[model samples]
Target: MPLVRIHLDTDRTTARRVLQLHREGRIHHESREAARDQALRQGRTPAGDPVFVGITNGRRDVQLLYDVEVYTDATR
Candidate 1:
């Protein structure tokens, strides 16, 4: 299993929205899953996707960090 950590430079509001959406089950799984889907859809690996992870309020941007681990076999 490889552990992947993604750091998103976002504001507080965005992070809150992500948490809310995840809690509401409006999307499948965690925000990390959504991020992975979005990354993969864009032809990129979820482990190395460049994204913003936070909310921007005025001159401040509160960013959130995410850690995702994927278990895989030797074949993968």
Candidate 2:
């Protein structure tokens, strides 16, 4: 899959959640839909489209950023 990035304006809780997951080394969901759905509400794990959505159909390795911007874990 290709790597991409997105800037999201979010709160601390959500940012921390993503950061921790990134530290663990992967940001994944059952599917892109699940990720997109998660981000719909406040304080939820942010994901979807360019972030969690994979090009070839699979889980994406997402890395965390300060505050909250979403991008795939390029190092992986």
Candidate 3:
């Protein structure tokens, strides 16, 4: 997917540059499902498609990607 980086500009040149950067893996990405799951947990979905997400990082500062149970040494 070609994501628009409005921070640069909305022109076609900027769009092309963003695409190039994305192809070079310079763009950061996260799971849409993760975002959706986190949003849904807050009682609303985002403006895009809905999807099921696993234990992705909700607490960005903690740098943890699993459930709290896993972090607390609880067995699944």
Candidate 4:
């Protein structure tokens, strides 16, 4: 499946929150830009610590695309 990577500002809390929302099905979109725009609209601003929101088939792609740490070791 194609993936969408959403770039976010530096904020661990907000980043995780957005990710959580996506995982929980609160946020659903097929495109990266759409997800990013929706995230921003939901209050995840691109300010200090930049984070990335990604929609992918798995977490590995998300980690690579966003250069963010993820807990996928168990899956591997």
Candidate 5:
């Protein structure tokens, strides 16, 4: 199963909560809908702050690299 990396514009607290859930194996590698459901249960806002950032096509390492690139580019 592919990994779903959800990026959020919310505060660190909320983002950390969601990341923790993912790391703890609570959120399975299912559809995006499943992730959204888990995130909601985990206290993520449904408005727009905590939104789907990106999805990895079974390339977790590459996803990290891409994220770093995007972040670096955005900082410029």
Candidate 6:
């Protein structure tokens, strides 16, 4: 499975909720679709293309940044 990292433009509440759903396996992989679907299901509007909820501190916190990696299993 590939790892997808998305920076969400959200606050602590959003982060907590998303993280919870993610941990509970509610979303499908950390891909864009998963995030978007999750947000939609929650009655929230997703940004676009791969939706990500990020956080901020001083000024802007949350954002949308992703990192994907492919993997394979082999048996000899």
The per-model lDDT (C-alpha) reads 0.50, 0.38, 0.32, 0.39, 0.36, 0.45
lDDT, candidate 3, 1-76, per-residue tens: 2111111113444344445555675632343344445544544424444322122223332121211111222222
Candidate maximizing lDDT: 1
lDDT for model 2, please. 0.38
Clashes of each: 6, 0, 0, 5, 0, 13
TM-score of 4: 0.30
Report the lDDT tens digits of candidate 2 across residue range 1-76: 3323333434455455655565676763333343444344433444325353222211343322222233344221
Worst 10 residues of 6 by lDDT: 67-76
Per-residue error for 37 in candidate 6, Å, reads: 12
TM-score of 6: 0.35
Whole-model alpha-carbon lDDT for candidate 3: 0.32
lDDT of 6: 0.45
RMSD of each: 6.7, 13.5, 15.2, 14.7, 13.5, 11.0
lDDT for each residue of candidate 5 in 1-76, tens digit (9 for 90 to 100): 1222443233444444545666675542333345455445544433322233433334233221101111211211
In TM-score terms, which candidate is top?
1
Which stretches of model 2 miss by more than 4 angstroms? 1-4, 28-76
Model 1 agreement with the true structure over 9-72: per-residue lDDT tens digits = 5556667787676566553245555656544554444444333333334467554555444334
| Candidate ordering by TM-score (highest first) | 1, 6, 2, 4, 5, 3
Worst 10 residues of 4 by lDDT: 67-76
lDDT of 2 at 45: 42
Q: Candidate 2 or 4, higher lDDT?
A: 4
Give the range of the ten consecutive residues with the poorest summed lDDT in model 1: 47-56
In candidate 6, which residue ranges exceed 4 Å CA deviation? Answer: 1-5, 28-65, 68-76
Report the Cα lDDT for residue 64, model 5.
13
Indicate the worst ten consecutive residues by lDDT in candidate 5: 64-73
* Native-structure RMSD, model 1: 6.7
lDDT of 4 by residue, 27-75 (tens): 3222334444544554444332223345233333332123222223222
**Candidate 1, position 47, lDDT:** 40
